[model samples]
Target chain A: MKYKVTESENISTVFLDGEIDMDVADNVREVVFPLIDSGKEVHLNLKGVQYMDSSGISVIVESNQRAKEKNTKVELKEVSQPVEKVLAMARKFL
Target chain B: MNTEATNLSEKKDFLVRSSSLKDVRSFSREVFEKFKIDENLREELVLAIAEAAQNIVKHAYKDYPDTQDRMAVRISCTDKELEIAFFDKGKPVEESKVKHRAIDDVKPGGLGTFFIQEIMDSIKFKEGDKPWINNLVLTKKL
Candidate 1:
């Protein structure tokens, strides 16, 4: 996966591109976790991401939990259709 | 427009590694397209297939990431149902211990199995005959 980050005063928007699976979940955590740790609201731009598996969802879930602990938040933005479908299925469990 | 025959089947083997999960999805999409499966249902099937494949890579081969093992995914469709089977030679799967975490526990790690359960009609784990150790079969009605 490929990612680009944009930072404002207190929020970091990460534009993630490519398919996300177990192979790339750790890399995603590596990218998003520190931003949450810095007490910044993180916005993940999923416009370019067309596929995300459970592993990717785990990253989102973990990031959300961690953001809550850090007193910030992580929001998903411009979620693609495929990812939206997966998220809809995951929402059943969440 | 799906005039293709319903009695279709395809199988492919991938290296049992996390990186091969993409290849597993790609192969599944190709077979689904060839089989003329419903457009709306294709991605869900792909996700189910990829999740099962990921389980093999993550759980079965947990101790041997560098091993050159390969796992096979076979997708077969009959007139009444679609069946996807996974054959792996990794550590034997303990059927009793394969349940997903309770929904009340809300966690990141167990969603794969949960998603599989949600998408597929039935999931069965069987002991493979030879050369393979675990046989996972997931089916959905067409």
Candidate 2:
């Protein structure tokens, strides 16, 4: 996956582009976690993401939990149709 | 449009690695398109197929990360139902140990199996006939 991050004051918006699976979940965490650890609100822009599997969903859930622990928040933005469908399937968990 | 015959089947084999998950989804999407499945349902089927394939890579081959083993995915569709079968030579799966965690647990790792169970009408684990060691069959009414 290719990602671009823009920082505006405290919030960092991460633009993730590509298919997300187990192969790329770690990289995604590596990118999004540090920002969350810094206690900054994070926005994940999923407009360019074409597909995401259960592994990717795990990253989102873990990130949300971690953000809560650190007193920060992670928001999903511009979720693509494919990714949204999977997220919808796991709505109760979220 | 009736783009395909009444009965259709396609199968593909891929390296049993996390990276191959994309190829698995691609193959599934292609087959669904050829079968003229609607977009929304097609995506759900692809997600179900990919999750099952991911289980093979994550659980079955957990010990053989660098092994050169490959797994096969077969999708067959008829007028009334669609069946997907996965063939792998990885560790034998004890059917008793293959349950998805409780949905209310709100955990990360176990959601794959939950999604599969939610999407497919029935899931069965059977012994492979030959060199293959594990076979998971999932079916849904089309």
Give per-residue CA lDDT, model 1, range B1-142, as digits (tens).
2645578899999999988989999999998888888888899999999989988988899899998989999999977789999999999999888877775454434688988999999999999879999999999988
- Candidate 2 chain B, run of 10 with poorest lDDT: B101-110
TM-score, structure 1 vs. true: 0.95
Cα DockQ of the candidate 1 complex = 0.66
Can you tell me the CAPRI class of model 2?
A: medium
Model 1 docking tier (incorrect/acceptable/medium/high): medium
What DockQ results for candidate 2?
0.56
Cα RMSD, each candidate: 1.5, 1.8
Error of 2 at B4 (Å): 4.5
Fnat of candidates, each listed: 0.66, 0.50
Q: Which candidate number maximizes TM-score?
A: 1
Candidate 2 backbone collisions, by pair: none
Candidate 2 per-residue lDDT over residues A1-94, each given as its tens digit: 8999999999999999998888898999999999999999999999999988778888998899899999999999999988988889888554
Which DockQ values do the candidates obtain, in the order shown?
A: 0.66, 0.56
lDDT of 2 by residue, B26-129 (tens): 89989988887767688788889988998898789989999799999998888778899999999999989887766545443468887898899999999998
